[model samples]
Target: MATLLLTGASGLVGSRLLPRLVEAGHTCRALVRSEVALPDGTTGVRGDLADPDALRQAVEGVEAVVHLAALFRTTDEDAVWRANLDGTRNLITAVQTYAPRARFFMASTGNVYDAAAAQPGRETDTCSPTAAYPASKLAAEALLADSGLTWSVVRLPFVYGEGDGHLASMPGLVDRFGLHPAHTYSVAHHRDVATVVGMALAGTFDGRVVNLTDDAPVTVYEMAAFAGQPIDGSSEPLVNPWAGRMDSTVLRGFGFRPAVPTMQAAARDGIL
Candidate 1:
């Protein structure tokens, strides 16, 4: 069993991952900014991601680290930079100083690629992150690479499951905006995401950028139909499109396959 330190344990992915890791007979520790209830046997450390000293304390003695704490978006670019870029630098530095040999896994978004690009984006594709979220993630990936630690970066597509507010709640958006059927995107279940991370922590893959996504792609109109909601024709143009279909061959080679496909089924099963 390995001692794993997870940042952002209060978030959707981390919360799901913690229980799974425990069930797998691994000891888990979480670093959080505030006091929160955690499962028995799980340790919690109160600290900010920007503080290198606090981050070192959280990472100390763990065999592996999963860095998932990141700000998705912000009105101010400076806040985005500090939270995503500087915070990642702090964490990387702490890992280097306090736990140099520990394996590091980072969660990145597929938005780092240009949305208008062709389908099935490969790991080697040049990144063109137009938005703040992807830009920060790309920057963090670079920082981690330079840290001289064994690291794996998972560039995730839209992840949905129970408690997933963004992708899971899209059916309501379709209803409200009256969207169309042509808007399509790829997605993976939250459990699948956790499973991929588990594989990474287990040292199944090394120094690779794997894409975590499902085998099939689904459109918003189909999702609305699955939810038994009316597909409106008016809100088609306002939809923000995803990057593109992602190639998951690397992840599949590691024995990671998504259990759920369509967002509709994920929502129906309460998985998203």
Candidate 2:
């Protein structure tokens, strides 16, 4: 079994990803900011992503690295830049010094794509990054591109499911607003996000950037109804709109597709 170093192993995606990695017969060395409950047979290392010394210790002896640590807000430009860009720089430096041959899989966001007033964004599309979160992620991707290691970047859309604070709070927006808002949206389950990371780690694909998204685009109304709280009205425009589509052809070509489709399924399964 390959020894894997996983940063952000205690966050939403990382928490779910740990179990899956273990179940797949790989040993995971997880880096967390503090002590937390973890599954048996897994090793937890305390480290700050911003600290190169701590990062080096965390990656020691690991055969592969799955980087899931990053600030996930569209706001807070400074925090996003430091956490995503500087943190990635630290990790890359450590890997180069100690684990240059290890495979590196960086988790990025689909928001890196240019904010188009359309659907189904392909992997080759130009990046716009309207918000701090996407902008920082794109910067991190650029850092990895020149790192000279065997690496792949997985650009994921909004991932919802258990432990997803942003998505769980989405239902409240519907109650306050209404269905058929002005903007459209796209979503994927956390399990799928973890799966995509695993696929990249397994070296099953050659593409540098892979988009991870669901089968279809989902609107705010559809998501609200799935949460068992329908929007108040249909006339209210969807406010604060963002890009709601991604082309997952590159990911699917590697046999990775979201098993979960509808928001209702995600809610029912305790994933949303």
Candidate 3:
């Protein structure tokens, strides 16, 4: 069992991950911005990502760091940069000084890839971030590369399940973002996401940039059907062109299998 320093313990993925870490025999020390109780048996320390002293305190005697903290929906570009980029520098500095030998795992997004590509995005594919959220995440990945630490990054897909409202909001999101009915997107269940993190902590894939996604991509029409809402197909030009697909072969090559393989499976199993 290893001692791990974790950030974003209060968020969706983090809330799910903390308990699994404990059950796996790993001790987790969570970094929180407020005085919130962590999953039972784990410890919490109040801190912002940019506070070096706070990071230092939270990182003591840990074998690894799992960074799931990031700004995804804060529309302000500068706020996105500050949280996703500048805050990363603060964590890096603290890790260099206090936990240099610990393995670093960053939660990244598939959005870091070019959305216009013809094929599913792979780790070796070129990155062309189209928005502030992805751009900032990519920048943080660069910072981790230069931090001289042992690291691995997992680029996550559109995550859902465990009562997360992402799937339920698809119809509204498609309308709000001008998405097409035929658009296809890769997805992963929150259970599999937690499993992937547990595997990362076990050192299954280190010094690697792996994409974690399901085996298939779902079209927007299917998404609408799943949500019990029908949509008129292609009212606007398809803006996201990558087929919204990610190749998860590398992750499977590392001995990982998704528990909930598709949204259909999630809905049938009452997880959606």
Candidate 4:
């Protein structure tokens, strides 16, 4: 059992993940900017990512750091950079000073991959993201890599399940991205995210950038229908067939297996 400092505890993923970590016997200290109800047994450290003194207090004596705070789907580019890039830099500095031995786990996005790639995004792919959110995350990844801390980066795809409504939001995203009905994208369930975090605690993902997703990559049309919010169907050829897909070979090689393996399975089990 390790003591962990977790940022973004109130976010979609972090809120769900904290309870699982507590249940797993790890002592979780959540860094929060405001008063929020945390999981039972979690210690809330009052601070945002920009506060250096607060970051120092948060990381001190922790065995690991789980960074899940990031800004996306916003029109404000400056806020995205401040939260994703500048925040990461500050956290890295704090960990380097206060908890140098702690392992770091950063949650990144699969959107960092080039939109026009011919195949699913791989860890070693050359990424050139034009969007602010992904660009900032990619830059943060570089900072962590060079920070010389034992770190792991997981590029998450479309995360859904546990009634987070992330899947339900896809119909509008389909229209926003101009994707064909047949365009497939990778996704992961909240439970499977907990599973990956467990792996990080066990030192299975150190010094690696892995893609996390379910076994089957599903199409947007199917996902929308499954969510009972179907988008307009299309037979036109997809311009970017591989836009939101990712290669999960590295995760598989690490013996990672998702608890929720498919969105259809999730729907059938009433977990979606």
- Summed backbone clashes in each candidate are 4, 6, 1, 0
lDDT score, candidate 3: 0.86
Per-residue CA lDDT of model 2 for 119-159, tens digit only, reads 56777887767687888888889889899988999887777
Write the residue-wise lDDT of candidate 1 on 1-272 in tens digits: 78988888888677877888888888888998999888788898888897766787888988899888888645787788788899988888888889899999999887787766665677888987867878988999988877899999998886666755655466776667554566766788877887888888877888888888887777776655554564654543634454446888888988876777556567668665
- Residue 17 lDDT (model 3): 78
Candidate 2 residue pairs in clash (backbone atoms < 3 Å): 114-128, 161-271, 162-271, 181-238, 182-237, 182-238
Root-mean-square deviation of candidate 2: 2.8
TM-score of each: 0.88, 0.88, 0.94, 0.97
Best by lDDT: 4
Query: Of the candidates numbered 1 and 2, which has the greater lDDT value?
Result: 1
Per-residue alpha-carbon lDDT of model 4 for 161-234, expressed as tens digits?
89997888888887796768898989999999999988987889799999999999999899989889888887
Give lDDT for model 4. Answer: 0.93
| Model 4 residue 227 distance off true place after TM-score fit, in angstroms | 1.2
Give a tens-digit lDDT track for model 3, residues 1-272. Answer: 89998888888788777888888888889999999877777988888898878899988778899999999786799999999999888898888889899988999998888877878899898887869999999999989988899888899988888776777788998879877888889999898988888788777888788999986788888888887787877656666567578999999999888888778888899887
Candidate 2 has what TM-score? 0.88
